[model samples]
Target: MKIDKGISLTKVELDRIEANFLAAWTGDNSTPFIVDAPISASLRTRGTAIVRQTNLYTLFQLCPTLATWAVLTPLAIDYGASNKNVYSHISVFTNKNFDDAQAREKLKERFRFAARRIGLPVVGNQPTELFFAPLGPARSQLPDMARAFVGAALHLGPPAVEDTPSARDWQRRAVATRCPNLTRLNATISFDRSAYCARRFEAWRRGNEPLTEAEALLFAAYDQAVIGFGRHRSDLVAPPRLFWNGFTLALEAEPSQSAQSIKLGPFPTQLPGGSQVAIRTPWPEKITWTAGSIAQDIEVAPASDEILVFDADSGVLLTRTALETKVIAVASERQVVIASEQFGVTSFGPSIQSADPGRFIAWTITGDELNFPGRLPPWDHITSRDGALDQCRLDRPRRNAYSFGVGWRVDPQNRSRCRRPNQNSPRTIR
Candidate 1:
């Protein structure tokens, strides 16, 4: 009854059973017990000796289910370190009734399945030289024999689905919690970059470092605009193209010291399809003028505490802000302006007499403040100069705003204008 050790069957008994079965089923002298019958008497004697010693015959006698099967023990020579060889002792059991062509096809199919399960490249019909390279440890190898046994068991009794968290579920939760603000700006962000940001945030939380004004602003933007409220809404509006345009302009501009002469404009004159041409002076006295003719003479003058933008053709002023800040401008069909102070990057739009004032978007570099407008701000709010002054409101107060940890800490030597708060101490914006 112990099947693992196998049963003993004499050659005479095996031959007799085969003869009886052949006689009863088909009137022939063929025997299914032997594979490739001997041609000469001497060869026949040698094959008979080999057959008696084989575990295949014993396996059949021990397990009645294997009676109609042929055993193929595939020996794989695995190479180890230092040119040493390690032999893999493996076996494959298949039906004996299968023809040469059927057996070959079956072997290949099994090999392909095993290769795929182990993340290996499969070859057609037979294994190629490329397949022989040792990919990993032999213990992790999925051979055809294991696949066959496991497949047969699973087919008979399939496993139930367990109530456990899957990879997809984890990914969904991560995307929802990490960068919800990005959902509105999804087209502008790459998945790799978002994942990287998530990792950075996690690292910052663990280390407890102070965040720079730019870092704090970007983090708050992702938190307020994306994760906190953006993803839940079905009708999310796209940020304005001008907002991004202005933001890009500010990002490219060289960082200047306080009260330094930073250039603001030499922006293109014409509107997208309009005839108006524009020109502007550099910082200290930031002024812009747009006219129909490029040859029109206009005197450029610097103003100490004001940033001015105007359309000379219509003699209409677009925007005027008197904040003590550094200014940078981008000119096109529409005017874009960026102003950076100790707090963060703030954007504003131009005021056209008949049109609504431009939108505002600001990212406060200081952690203590959160400015969420009743409406979603324009995308280009970070770079635009229009409506910049009206949008500079400290609506909400956040404690420990800049405490992301060591990775985001602003060096004290560079903290000339901005105060460096204690990393562990909570701070509030007025």
Candidate 2:
């Protein structure tokens, strides 16, 4: 329980260490198993069940096939009088019976240890991502993320558009306000390690040394098929809400109420290949989307809500502080202007330099925080340019400063201290 100060680790770090160990040796997402959703519904998989190749115990004599080595394995075991938390039931369904009120309630939610390899799921690298869901790869994003008057016109400069998440699943926190009906289902089962194997792991835990390949050969890979039923729950009845269809918008099933503002934002939305997304709302509702600057009451039913759809526009949003004025630079005879990539957004350029389009004196910058770091009170500026990147003509812009608006939180807490970002951030004519 108590380790040397030097080796003591935070809970997250300790879990990470165990996860790495599991991934290196036991991260086999291919093992076959089954689980019950409700008491009546069962889920199964395809793979070779883990079984011992050789039998050395008396079970073979008593009943050759009926009492296989797997049958004899204990669910858990202990040695000393006190072995507090030696074996963890991490992410396993402790209560497998859904019919029992208490058991189902207990099964309602169980934390998954970061070491998912200990459980029997072939999870990919990111444990945060779930393998099973009703949806497939999302081709869209949420829409209009600016914390300020997002659905309305600019309060300061332009609409602040932030970075977005894949439309596969909405973030739980952001979706909470929309009051969407959410159903959760968990499966109960632990098919990776046996009680004796866990006891061995307890011993290994002290030494902090992994088993040698030859040492590992002595252990047997085991499996079981006694997964019981888990649990499920639905959200409380609430206001009508809109669901991201991964490409557009759809109304959730709810008793229709007239004149409701179905907020479609707080998440930035986008479509693949930069195609326009047509928002489809439920038919027969008098919809009114009103913000400070723009209020549109459009009732386009049995049809996509193109003009009224919050996520409909795919144009790059300039920040509220963005300049209303415009600056145009014309490139000719191999001379060019440029826009560089930032914040995962792709970009192109008129090259003072050239990959293939030829070269000229590249458009210059005063400063770049990311690509080029500046010094002395950190004055960011372009000293020279072999080729040019757009948007660099201003700030000596370190990427942090460049990203200040649009997606960044930009110190909202300090809004009272400094309201509008007083910067010379400029955009090029794309």
Candidate 3:
């Protein structure tokens, strides 16, 4: 069999090759001597069992030099089962007790030279490094002989050469080729829609181009909905106010030049078993009040420009002040009386029980009467108009003090009349 150019195996070498093949096939573990024969022919004769045994040692022994063995190992394995045992054995045995760094450098040089000999591109410094050691998993590197064979078969083509352009450069080129008019200048890539619009607006401003119809609509909608008209103005015509009603007016108060300083009197004496309390101005404005508590019914009476909160039973004054304020009187088992000028109040306490949960009344007097300047509806005839109110028109006496018509009325004919079940008895309204 022809092993290389101008080299032919004699009868003795072919006999030795067949003997090693039969020995390995019969499971002989003895180290078989090498024979000068084509690895392909030996593989066909012995099958994959050649590499699974010590037959690879026979092939390496027969080869003239490591270079020849390197170029033929992969070919033999490819013709066999492509099992890694042969390659692994080659790596360990050849490099045993050898300097790893020096051996690696030599193998790399030889592999590159052999690849170039086969018309492969040997570009850049250490181009062999791509397929050599450290590129794949550790211990993946085969012996010098095995690497030379596999490298030639696997990487001996133009496709194996590393291309010059980066992935980003190729992607940009592809986009430009597909859409020639697309410009990336001053463009911002963002996941946020607001940021995208802002970037688009800035780009349009820098380019000095008229806004597209879609861009104009986007800007107008964003400005009117998210950014109020007072703070931001869009270049496009303002969007029509679809829900604007004349009754809903936006009122902006003028900033006060100076805040009024309110002086408060001493707190009223605490009741027995009362808890210690601390009160401070709810706002940054300098205002103080006399902290106090009261039991029994409390009455808030407005006199001229001043307001007074006093106990109705004893007629003792609790607070006398003039300010837009709110009063909260807790009439539960434990009473907590608080009067504050703050617009909002937050309270905490144990849940209270009531026979009629909806009968409880808490009123807020904001000093402004909410008036609809129009003729009022006839609430007495509401049952005739709305079927839902028919059940409420029973002739029986109203048991709930909070039932309709007690504190509400409709002056449909510009006349008001109080309705009481027993007006002659002089019932007191609480």
TM-scores for all predictions: 0.15, 0.18, 0.16
When summed lDDT is taken over every stretch of 10 residues in candidate 2, the lowest stretch is 39-48
lDDT per residue (tens digit) for residues 313-375 in model 2: 322211112111111111111111211211111122233322312211132222211121121
**lDDT value for candidate 3?**
0.25
Q: Which runs in model 2 stand beyond 4 Å of their true positions? A: 1-174, 180-370, 373-430
Clashes of 2: 26
Q: Model 1 off-target regions past 4 Å? A: 1-3, 6-77, 80-106, 114-123, 126-134, 137-430
Ranking by TM-score: 2, 3, 1
Q: Which candidate should be chosen as best, given lDDT against the real structure? A: 1
Clashing pairs in 3: 70-145, 70-149
- Between 2 and 3, whose lDDT is larger? 3
Which has the higher TM-score value, candidate number 2 or candidate number 3?
A: 2
TM-score of 1: 0.15
Q: Which candidate number has the best TM-score?
A: 2
lDDT of each: 0.26, 0.22, 0.25
lDDT tens digits, residues 325-350, model 3?
Answer: 21212112221112221112112222
